[model samples]
Target: MTRELARRDGLFGPIRVLERKHDGARLYCINGSLQTLMLADGVSAFGYVHAAKILVAEAPNVLIIGGAGGSLATMLATRGHSVTVIDIDPAAEQIARDFFNLPPQVRWVTADPLHFITAQEGVFDAVIVDACDSSGIVSPFDKPGVIADLLMKACPRGSLVVNIVAEDGAPPWGGWLAAKLASLGLSVCLFRSEEGWEGNEILHVRVDGPTDRLAITDLEQRPPEARTYLMSLRPHVASHVPVPATSDNGAS
Candidate 1:
C-alpha cells in the first residue's frame, strides 16, 4: 500500500510525495510524472538512474540539468563523484531533502538549466539532462540546435546522458536528438526497454571518443538489488535499428 506524505503546487503543477509501506520507497511526482524514486536508505529505485550511473562510472564530476528529487545526484555523490544538480524550482531542493532524503553533500543550484549551462564556467565529466515538466521535455531542449549548443558547452569532451519519457504513444524525442548529435560528430547510442512500451528512453552521447559500445562490466559489480534494472537497458545505434536477439549492447 502507498500513502501520501505531502502535496503542493510547484512551478509546473502539483507536486507530490508518496511512500510505499511494504518497501519504504518514496516516490516524487511532478505534474503527474514519476520524476524520482528513492529507497528507504536514499538509494535510487529507478532503472534509468542505474543505467546513467553505469554510463558515467568513470566520471569524477557530474552535472544534472533537472533536480526533481535529486536521485541521480544522490547516487553519483554516494559513489564519490562531485555532483551538481540544477533546477528552476527553488522548492525542489527542500522537498527532495525533506521527503526524498537528498543529502547536503550534493550541490543544488536554482536557475533555469539553459541559463546555467550557457553561463557556468566549470566543466563536468558527465552531463545528464532529465529536464521536463507536465507537457514533456521543456523548451530549448525540445529544439535540437539549442540543446546541442548547451551540451557542447557543458561537457565538451565527456559523456552525456539524456532521459526522455514517452506518454500516450507520443514520439520519442531522444531518437531525433540522437541523430542530431550524431550528425555533429558525436557517437550516440539510444537505450530502451524491450519488455515494455511506456518508459524512459535514454540517449548516451560521447562528444569525443572512439565508437566503441558502452561497457557494462561495472554494472555487474553493483549491488544485486540493482541488477534487474541495470539489465533491462538495451542499446540501439539509432532509433531505426532492430532489437537484437541478444541484449549484448552493453550498459545503457
Candidate 2:
C-alpha cells in the first residue's frame, strides 16, 4: 500500500513516496533537494551525515552540511548536542520540519556551507554529511575540498568528524581524505557504522597530535566493537589503508 506524499507549494524538486519494511511506514524523497527515509520505528532518517558523532562520548557543537529529513539533526539535539544544520534548499528544510518533526532546538541555517564559513572562524566537535539520492547513491556536491576546509577551520585541532560512504572498489578515499586531514594536523580514523549496507562511514580527525601519525595499521587494532561496527556497513572493507594526508597547498 503506497500513498502520495504531500507536496509543498513553490517547492522546487521531484517528489516520490518510499516505503520501508516492518511497520510499513512511508517516506518522501524530494529528489535533488532532500529525502525522507522512514525508519522502521515510525521515525524518519534524514539520510544526512551524523554517524561521526558516535565517537563523541558527549555531543558538542554539531554542524550538518545538508538537511534532508533532519533525522541526524534531531538525534543530535535529542542527545543534548548543540546542533546547527544548513541547507541550500529552503523547500527541503520546510518539508523536513513539516513532515519529520524537526525540532526547534536544532537551528536551521539556509546558506552555502562554504560561504557561511569563509567569512567567519568557528569550531565544532562534530560534523555530519548524510545527503544523497533515493537510490542510496551519493549526490555530487561542490568540491570535496570545501568540506575538508570547513572541517579544518570549524573544528578545533584534532576534533573534526567526516561521515562518508563506503562501497566495493570505491577508490579508497579513506587514505586520501585522512591524509589530507593529517597534513592539516588532524589524526584520522575511519570507522564503519552499525547501520550496514547504507554506505555509511565515519572519519574522525584529531586536530592536534604528538606528530606520531596514526598509521592505518593501528586502526586495525581498534577494539572489536569498532571493527564489528565498521564491517557491518562495509562487508568488503579489507585491512585498512593509509589515506592521503592533506597537501600544504590547502586545496582541500
Candidate 3:
C-alpha cells in the first residue's frame, strides 16, 4: 500500500511526497515524473538519477543543481562529502526538509544554479546536474552553455555527473550534449540503467590525461541498481545512439 505524505504547489506543479509499503521508500514526485527517494539518512535509491552518485568518489565538496527531495545531497553528505544543493523553489526545499529529512549540514541555497555559481567562493570536486521540473529538463540546464559553466566551475581534478532520460527510439540528447561535454576537455562515459525497458543514463565525466581519481571499475562497491548500470558500460558509451529508423520501402 502507498500513501501520499504531503503535496506542495511547486513552481512546476504539484510536488508530492509519498510513502510506499513495498520498498518503504519516501517517493518525491514532481510534474508527473518520479524525481527521487529518501530511503535512509544519506542513503537513497529508487530513483535512477538519485542513485547516480555511485559513480562519483573522493568528492568532498559536491554540488547538486536540483533539490526536489535532497536525495543526492543526503547520500553525498552521508558519505562524508560536504554537499550544497541549489534550487529556485522555496517550497521544494521545505518539503525536502520536512518530509525527506534533508541533512542539517547541507547548504540549501534558494537560487538559480546559473547565478548561484557566479557568487561561489570555491569550486566543487563534483557537480551533479540533475536539474529538472515537472515538464522535463529545466532552464539553464536545458541550455548547453549552462552545463559548460558547471564544468568551468569545477576543480581541475574534478568530475561532473549528469542525469539524462533515455528512451527506446529517441536520442538522449541528439549526441550533441555529449559532444558539447567533450569539448570541455573531459572524457565522458555513461551508465545505462536499463531494466527491461529503456532507463535513464548517468554521464560520468572526468578530465582527461592524469588524475588521482579511481576508474569506473570502482563502481563495483555501489548498490545493485548502480552496479547494474556500471556493468552495462562494457567498453564505453560515446554518445546517445538512437535506434535506427524504419522505412516504408517494400522489400522483395
Candidate 4:
C-alpha cells in the first residue's frame, strides 16, 4: 500500500513523501519513481542502513558524496565515525534535517562532490557514494571517472569506497563495472542486495588491499532488511586461475 502523505517541488526535483505499509517507512520518492531517501521508526530506511554495517567493520573516517537524506552521514556519525557530507543540492541539507532527523554532529557541505573532493585534496578511510536523481539514470555515477576520483580521495592504501548501484541483469554494466574497478587497481567485491530495491548491489572497492567477505552472520548493528540481505550471503570470494600448461600430448 502506498499513500502520498506529502510532497514538494524543490531544486533537486519533485519530492514525494510517501508512506509504505510493508516497512512502515516514510519514503521520499523523487519524481514518482526512485525512492532516493527514507526514514523508518526514526531510523534510516535507505540502503545506507546496510552500508553502515559494512563500514563499521572497516571505515573510521567516512566521506559521503551526495548527501541525499543525510541518512548515511547520520548513521555513521552516531557510530562515532568522523562524517562529512557534500551535496550539490542545497535543499537536501534542509530536507535531511527537517524530515530525516539528521544529527548535528554530521557536517553538511553544499557543493558538487566532484569539485569539492578535487579542491580539498583530502583522503578518507572510506567513501560512501549514493548520488542518483529521478530522471536520466546512468551507470552508478558513471563508474569510470567517479571511481577513479573516489580512489584518489581514499587514503594511500587500504582505503575502501562503496558505491550503491541500482543494478539490473548483467553484462555491459555489471561485468564492465568490475573490469573498470579492477583496472583502476582496486579489489572490488560486488554484493548484490536482492532483498532491497530491484537490482540493488553494493560495490566495495578496497584500494590495493584484500577485502574479506561481508560478515552477514554478524548483523548485530544492522537493520532488518540489511541483515536479511547479508544473511543471504555465505561469505566467499572468487578465485582466478590460469589455464594449466599442456605437455607433449596436450595433457600435462
Candidate lDDT scores, in order, read: 0.75, 0.54, 0.65, 0.59
In the range 112-209, model 4's lDDT, one tens digit per residue, is: 67677778766777776666432212333544556755666655554544544444422223334555667666676655554644344555666656
> 87-205, model 3: which lDDT tens digit per residue?
88878888888888888999999987778788887888888888743323445554446565677676556877777665554445524455556655567665554452325656666
Q: How close is candidate 4 to the true structure, as a TM-score?
A: 0.76
RMSD of each: 6.3, 7.2, 6.6, 8.2
RMSD of 3: 6.6
lDDT computed for candidate 1: 0.75
TM-score for each candidate, following the candidate numbering: 0.86, 0.67, 0.79, 0.76
Order of candidate numbers by TM-score, starting with the best: 1, 3, 4, 2
Ranking the candidates on lDDT from highest down gives 1, 3, 4, 2
Candidate 2: where is the Cα deviation over 4 Å? 7-13, 17-36, 40-50, 132-148, 168-171, 193-195, 209-250
* Candidate 4 pairs with clashing backbones: none
Kindly list the per-residue Cα lDDT of model 1 for residues 24-106, writing each as its tens digit: 88899977778887887777766777778878888899999889888888888888999999989877999988887777899
Give residue 97's lDDT in candidate 2 (0 to 100).
Answer: 74
Q: How many residue pairs clash in each candidate?
A: 0, 18, 1, 0
The lDDT of model 4 is 0.59
Residue 118 deviation, candidate 4, in Å?
1.1
Q: Which 10-residue window in model 4 sums to the lowest lDDT?
A: 243-252
Q: Once superposed on the true structure, which residue ranges of model 4 sit more than 4 Å away at CA?
A: 1-6, 19-24, 36-39, 46-48, 133-140, 166-172, 194-198, 217-222, 234-252
Of 3 and 4, the candidate ahead on lDDT is: 3
TM-score leader: 1
